[model samples]
Target: MKRAITELFNRLRFKHKLFLSYLIVIIIPIIVLGVYAYKQSEQMLKIQGIGGIEKNVDTISGGINGSIERYNHSVQTIVYNKTFQKIVTNDYRDLVNLSYDLKEYLSPYFTMMTNLDKEIDEIKFYTQTYVPEYGESVQLASRVSEEQWYKEALKGTGSQWFSDNGIIVVSKFPQFSNDKDTNIVYMRINEASLFNNVAALAKDDTVIITDKQGRIIYSNQQASAAADKPVLNTAQLSALKEGVIDFGGAKSYLVKKPVALTDWTIYCIVPAAQLTQNAGSIINATLIIIALCILIVLIIIWIFSKTMLRRVLSLNSLMKRVEIGDLSMRVRSESKDEIGELTNRFGSMLIRLNEVIDELFRNKIVQKEAEFKALQWQMNPHFLYNTLSFINWKALRSDAHDISHVVTTLSKFYRTGLNRGDNIIPVQDELEHVRCYIEIIQTMRENSFDVVYDIDEAVFGYKTINFILQPLAENAIIHGINRKESGRGVLRITAELSGGKVVFTVEDNGNGMPPEAAKTLLESQSSGYGLKNVKERLQLKFGSDYSIVVESEVDQGTRMKIAIPA
Candidate 1:
């Protein structure tokens, strides 16, 4: 059997083998993960559903308490009223006075209470006084003496709430001055008002309110019925906890809350299947996702294996050509995988081999051509200097000393700037270059700006980048001195060795730019390339540690400084 399996695997194509391997590796774990995720999602939904039901129960309990509170307040009002108590407990000498008192005071008070709180359906007083019962509003205590709610109210010093025969009752029994007069004030609450909020619950959900004795006093299912129906049997009720339970052959989540006024417990029940209904769809989606992932992975394996095989075959063909001494063969690929890497290395090796074989002849020819080019370009700078000298001589012969001086300064500036194409020169030579530039500028502007040199002699021995300060001085005269409104501008050029580093500063007393403009002067091309070029040359010649800085203030002067390592 093992041999047969091996033969089958060996007969399969590379992509097929890759696909099979991936399938075997991922199928079991993906199934397990999908199942686990479904269970966890279902559990989370159950917990959230239970929590939601608990909140609803709390809200329902609050509404019921509010409805009961209003009726209880009415009962207390009638019980504590001195006049109402006196009227109810009064020993009437005649029926006419009793009738007059009821008509004038008692009747109007009850009517006002019922009108003020629409939830109060009726208000009745039960007493055993000799006074005759007027209407249904005034009744004999003996009529309710045997009732459970009445007996309970008589036992407690405070008020009591009772759900009896689809009616909500709040009663207050006050200690009367006459022992024979057991006075009770009763206010019946509108059942609709008591359960108004519970109507928002889901249709399948059920709410049950039970008295302290574990007897159902009210159920939404039997709300209109005269007698309360039992929702759960005795066994189920006894075994109920604040969690999932088996009810009516289906799993239901139950949350219970106690009513503060009556000590009654409110039970909220919802089917577990309803709570986790979405979990089934989620699981189905997860399974579909897993299947898609498997399909995508198989496709990727096939594509990758095919690509690798094609690249390897191409590499083999290139090698065969190379073996036939075709050294110019080349391959280009943008892939960054191992095969691509191998292809790149092979191409580089072939190029290096060809370079080694041809390097000697190539270098000799390049050297000969370079020499010929040098010979062709040797006369340009000398011709420029000679022309400048001839002009200076003609200017001197004509007695134009200023023109001669300007030409001489220009010649010197160009000579120092060239420095035989050397990038580094002595600090003294760089300083002389700046002086030449300033002289030419002053001659052009008719000495509008005066320049002071505070260069330390110690700096003269050090070598520096050529033409570093000339552009800076030019910028100072152009941007600063020329823009000054009043007073002659002064240019101060200073170079010194401080803290083992060379520092150069060019300060001009002219109309300075804003501080922000000064900070970006070396970076903005709109200002000109003079300062920016100097900055780039310094950083490139030295490392990035060397740089230029500018400080300026509006209406004040500007200062440019360059710092470089010695």
Candidate 2:
């Protein structure tokens, strides 16, 4: 069977093979997935609807319990009040004194407690003693002693919640009172305040809250008709399990949660068919999507096969042309596949071969021109040196000693600065270069500043870049000593070796600058051939680790230091 299949596949063209392979690999899986999704979507939607209803029931139960707790707290506050208990339990002789205590104290306290929570409609106290009613807030206990809700509150140790006449009542007996003298404090809350918090989450669902005895405390839909009635008859309530149920001949989903600290259960009911209403449309859309994907895959397979064949044929023709010595033609491909890579490699080989042949002839022409330029550059510097020498000789013959001295000093400065076009020189030669610059400056300024060299012998043999110290010396004389008002200024130069590094320091006691001026001296562009040029040259030769730092204070001397690896 395998041999037969292989023989059948080998008989097909390349495009036919690709189309058939894609049909089996891609289209078949999409169809299977679409069928599975169609079958599972109904059950999944039903499960999600039940889960959402369960959360809504829990939130509604929590909101109801919160309202009950708030009313209970207000009752407890009045029950434990010493002043209230004393007033309610006292045996009064005059009715006017009783009315004064009730009107002056108890009325304001009840009003204050009721004002604290917006949910509380009224707060009232029921006393067994005959304390005639002072407003509706103080009532006779005998009036409600025989009532069912009051009897139920007496049976419990703490507060009890009751739904009576569209209002919620929280009743608690006084802590200090005996059974014979029952003082009950009860707070009434409007039922709408408890239901409004969870109503938004229940949207289209019906919620029923029942007490421990299966009596419905509140029903969001049927409350006006069935308040304080049984949630359902015994036979029907037993059949109302969670998940799908047949309620009044319609399929529905039911979720139930118990309220904490209260024996109340909350029920949320939603229709089952309402939850899965869109399942049919989703199944039809899946089938359409599977068909569209198969059509697109087949179309893409055909175009891709045709494009591959055309590019392969073009590459073969180009290779044949290149075999006969034509290197100007180049191949172009936008794809990142194997065929594109092969075409690009072949084009690169032809380009590299042409470049090598052209570079061989160009190198010979450049070498000859460089030699001619070298001969031309050597004459200019020698001509300048000979002219300086002639000026020195004329100065001495004409008896101008100062002119001869200045011309000779200028000659030494240029010669050491040049250094035969070599950047790296001995430390001694760099010192000599700076010394010549200082002498020229002193001659121009008539020896106004004294020079002091604090040299360490160890740094003399080390190598450094030439013409570095000349700018520092020139700045010390021009900006420093020349600007001194009264006394002669002093310039100090120091060289030392420490921790595998060579350090040079230039200090001047002339009219000193502020610290800011000294620090930014190397960064200013106005100083031509100054400290900034020296810093760049040192960094280029010795890497960035070498640099110059400056330190100065107002009315004090300025000191510039250079450090480099030895």
Candidate 3:
């Protein structure tokens, strides 16, 4: 089985391998931990549900017991009151006088006791004597044995408790009256005020109070007429003594405690489903979070694998191109890791190979050009200079000074341009050469422009490539000065030694080119050869350290700066 699994893994692609790695390293462990956490959480919820139900039931039971004890105390107080007993057993010949006496004596005691406790609603004295009602608070009854509560009172000795529909505490006074009639003192408790606290405890549950005969007299849901039915039958009530019961088609937790004063039982019934609602919600939320986490992790894994493999495939494609003799192919990477280093090395190898091929090709053309230039230079200059000098002399003898000056300047321009077949010459000679070229331009243009020279004496001895400044001056005059709408221009040439370098500038106050046009002067195919030739020769001789920079703006004129190492 292990061999089969290994074979399957080996047959998969790199992305599949990465997915398997994540499943083992991240997903499986999370799933295991999530299952364990779910089980532990379920167990914890069960224990907590049981504990919480038990606590609430104990609290409600204690509150109910305390209320019964307070009512029992009230009953005992009324039963032993001598004033009340005397008022009940008094023999009055004048009925009006007796009624007045009853009110004066019993009214004060009932008012004082009932005022101290708001739970007692009515205090009544039931007897066979002719007693009129004093007020609604204290009642005098003529029939003692007719009422059900009175009959129940006679069955027990002291403080008999009964609730037919509402709570009543009845106590009989036998010693006070020797007649066949029995006098009873009973106080009816205010049902709402007596059980308000116990009812509050059953917010989402059910609380029921039943009499000794298992008849439910009070309930938390008493306001709802539909809930008036008995919740537990006698069999279920008997079974509830063990702690829990299944009744009314729902599993419920039952806590039953007997009220010592009334022998009634208070039952707190909580549904099993209600107890676990919060736990179920929590488990569902945890499941959603776990699923989202797994999805996010899978997305991250896919993106990472795709990015890494794409780079590797790009390098492989470039290698294939190189293998097919496309040596110009290169990998472009900015990373500093091992893959980036490999890409860089591969790119460097291609660059070197291309450079070797380019050098060999350039050498052959250079050799042929050098031989042709040497042959052309041997014949052209001497004949050209002699012809120009003859013209100058002939013009001078004829008293044509302008013609003589133009031919003389033209001769000097060509002589200096040759520079005795040398590539590098003194800075003074190059300046003199540019001056001659500018003079010829002035003569041809009817001297419409002015030329200024600002040369530092210290840089006069510095050597530079011949014809460098002459092309720049010619470019300024032809492209810049000649195109001006004003037709009047100024040309300035300056040279200075700055920071161990020879800085030369050729500037013109004329119509200037746009910025894009100025940038393309060095790179444009349509740009003339003169400026490009000078730039190339400078780079070839002095390496890339020396360069010419052109700055121009429309209507702002143009300036060209040439920098060479001193």
Candidate 4:
């Protein structure tokens, strides 16, 4: 199966392969992200919608409970008042005097209760005794035992609610003087004012207030006809919980909370579709934008893949030409892309190959010339040594010690410098060559400076480049000692083995060059031949790892340090 798949992929063109890759890498991810974002947004909207409805229900329930509490307090005030209680319990035969006393005692309590709450329209006291007829605010009951609310009020010990003419709160008064008649006191709140808070909700939302038996009391939809009022039948009400409901042919969020003072439940109903409308619109817009972006990206990929393939095919054809001995062919491209970089590298490789061929051809000619020069050097050095030996013998015979010493030093210097035509020699031999060169310099300058050696014996057997030290000593004598102002000049050569490397330093206590001059000594075009020659040779032999370091301060001294692998 894998072999078949590979063969099929190889047969497809490059552009088709790139298109397939774009579908996987770009198109698939966009679709997945859009779907995931929609789901998350939808869930968030549902939670927030339900939470808002619950808060509204809780707020309305709290306000209604507070209004009911105030009404109850009003009822209790009349029941416990000493003045009104006295009037109700006592009997008087004088109707005018009795009416005046009753009004005077209860008028103040009535005025305060009515003014305290807008919901309390009237406060009434009903009794069988002789009382003046003072409208509905204070009245006498002709037959009090016949009313249902009156019987219900008698059954309970405390305050009770009833829907007679309006919502009435009736509380029974105790029989103070052992009479067969019972006195009842009630406060009536208008039905419209009772559910005023719920009516202030949004028009689309429905609020219903129900008694403990699940019978509707005050509803925001009460203005509608009885048939049009929202009804949750017993079965639907039983099915309804606290969160969401799907009754009445519509989906809605339901919030139910019971009023604390009264056992009435307040329901806030919000439609589900209204809550998530904005989220749905946003999701649709996002999917459209993603689809448009994917279209643009695919177009760009098609154009870019074709351009890139053309360059690659061009490079392939050039490589074929070079394979068959056509080295003159070259690729030219102005682009800064990877393919252009490949062309530049190929061009550089060809140039280097040509240079190497030319260098090999020139080396053959140089090799023969070196052999001829070697033969000439062998003969000329023998003759020069013989002549120097003859000069030394004659000076010895004539008892000229200075001349004999000079000739002998010159002979040793030449012999060590040659070193049988080998580039590398022992440290001891290089040091001996420096000593001979220094003797000649001292003789020529009339001993202007002194030479000192602080070399370690262990480094004497180690190999070093020949003639490295002699040039440094010559520079010290010619440039440093010859230019000193006052104090006696001193030349010091030291060598030691450190960290598996040989370090040789040539120091001179003579007139020193400036710091800038010392720093550029090796690279300066005006620098003497000896310093530049030593720098180049060290770099060529050790590939820049070994080098010469020069440190100098004006009028102080100069120090040249050479470090090489031991």
* Tens-digit per-residue lDDT, 135-154, candidate 1: 98888889888988788877
Candidate 1: deviation at residue 563, Å? 93
Clashing pairs in 2: none
Worst 10 contiguous positions by lDDT, candidate 2:
222-231
**lDDT of candidate 4 over 490-518, digit per residue (tens):** 99999999999999999998889997888
What's the true lDDT of residue 40 in model 2? 58
Go through the candidates in order and give the clash count of each: 0, 0, 0, 0
The global C-alpha lDDT for each of the candidates, from Candidate 1 onward, is 0.77, 0.74, 0.75, 0.75
Question: Clashes in model 3: which pairs?
Answer: none
Q: What is the C-alpha local distance difference test score of candidate 4?
A: 0.75
Ranking by lDDT: 1, 3, 4, 2
In candidate 4, stretches whose alpha carbon ends up further than 4 angstroms from where it belongs are 1-13, 19-379, 444-446, 519-529, 544-547
lDDT for each residue of candidate 2 in 324-369, tens digit (9 for 90 to 100): 9777776765545577677788888878877886687467546634
TM-score of each: 0.39, 0.39, 0.37, 0.39
Report how far off residue 534 is in candidate 3 (Å): 99
Over 139-178, each residue of candidate 3 has an lDDT whose tens digit, in order, gives 5564445777676676778777787568787877666344
lDDT for position 148 in model 3: 70
